[model samples]
Target: GDSTTPDAIRTRTLTEETARVFRSRVVNPRWIAGMRKHGYKGAFELAATVDYLFGFDATAGVVPDWMYATLAETYVLDKENQDFLKHANPWALHAMVEKLSEAADRGLWSEPDPELMDQLQQVYLDVEGDLEDRVS
Candidate 1:
């Protein structure tokens, strides 16, 4: 007999299915352009973050989709909270990124806690140095 529980269901998600669903959506370039507001520096940081999280060996494609799903879910669960995470600290930011990487490793992407998000945002902002100037 198979047990049915929310956690179990989530744990059993198929990586291939996740990837297929993402590919069909026809992503909007505006979003990528928006994220590019950070420019190459921002892009580097995000790439590094993803690399660190999901192990640098292989399966990079799977990790990004998981990252997107995690962020999307977080956004849906608590938009306000996610916004706050976009405003967190440096050390905390690095740590949250690591957590995300770990989640990706386990094939279970998830949104960071508000506190972790805060740290990540803060770190990125702090290291970014005058994000306003860079974005514009």
Candidate 2:
């Protein structure tokens, strides 16, 4: 019976309703505080710092596919959100690629728009390249 609801519709509705709340309550305040303390300029930088401080599994090289898929479905679909990710640190951006790859592998989330995926992938590559250059 419950199968009557389409996955895309459910996901879109859930994300639209909760995205603002999640950003305001979970993301923004902490970002503002971090900006004050660490000079993070935007959402991407803040996400990277938070990921670094919390030591997300990707830091340990153990990315969970379902989690990444969920993140993409919930957070990465919007242009503004994707822009925030563009400025993310290398590790964080790499984690996004890993997540998206995992989603692709498992067919977990709906297919993201091709352009959005391309943009995110480009950002990931740019950040990774920058990090590599710094190390070299």
Candidate 3:
């Protein structure tokens, strides 16, 4: 039967291709326009600003699990937990949608369920831990 597998593959390919475009169209221009966007005076400031949203250079090729987790976690975090997302990598649309679906299923957006919150928090922490291990 026709299934979501093919759609998933197509989505993955599209995400990778568009990420390259984002690097050129979004990342590049963000640097050029840094003075307006972040009041930055030079490349250093622009680089640091983009670093938060784009992840490290190596992560460009890998899917960003952290962004998806951030979206899921956002529904459950207290103010302190939200602060953790500043370090999250920007995830592809595919991952974000998947996480959003899971978050919805767990009712994270509709209610303050502690069990679901724990699950989302663990996912976020795990992704960060994995990234750290890979980088180190």
lDDT of model 1, residue 88: 37
Candidate 1 error regions (>4 Å): 1-108, 130-136
With candidate 1 superimposed using the best TM-score fit, by how many Å does residue 22's alpha carbon deviate from the native? 27
The list of candidate 3 runs beyond 4 A from truth reads 1-108
Candidate 2: deviation at residue 72, Å? 5.8
Model 3, 1-136: lDDT tens digits are 2245876544345456545544564335343344234332332333343343334323443324443344344322433323323233312212333344454454433343456456655655655565567679
Model 1 C-alpha lDDT per residue in residues 27-66, reported as the tens digit of each score = 2334434444664454444444444435531454344544
For model 3, the local distance difference test gives: 0.40
Q: lDDT (CA) for every model shown?
A: 0.43, 0.49, 0.40
Tell me how many residue pairs clash in candidate 2: 0
Clashing pairs in 2: none
* Decreasing lDDT order of the candidates: 2, 1, 3
Off by over 4 Å in 2: 1-88
Worst 10 residues of 3 by lDDT: 85-94
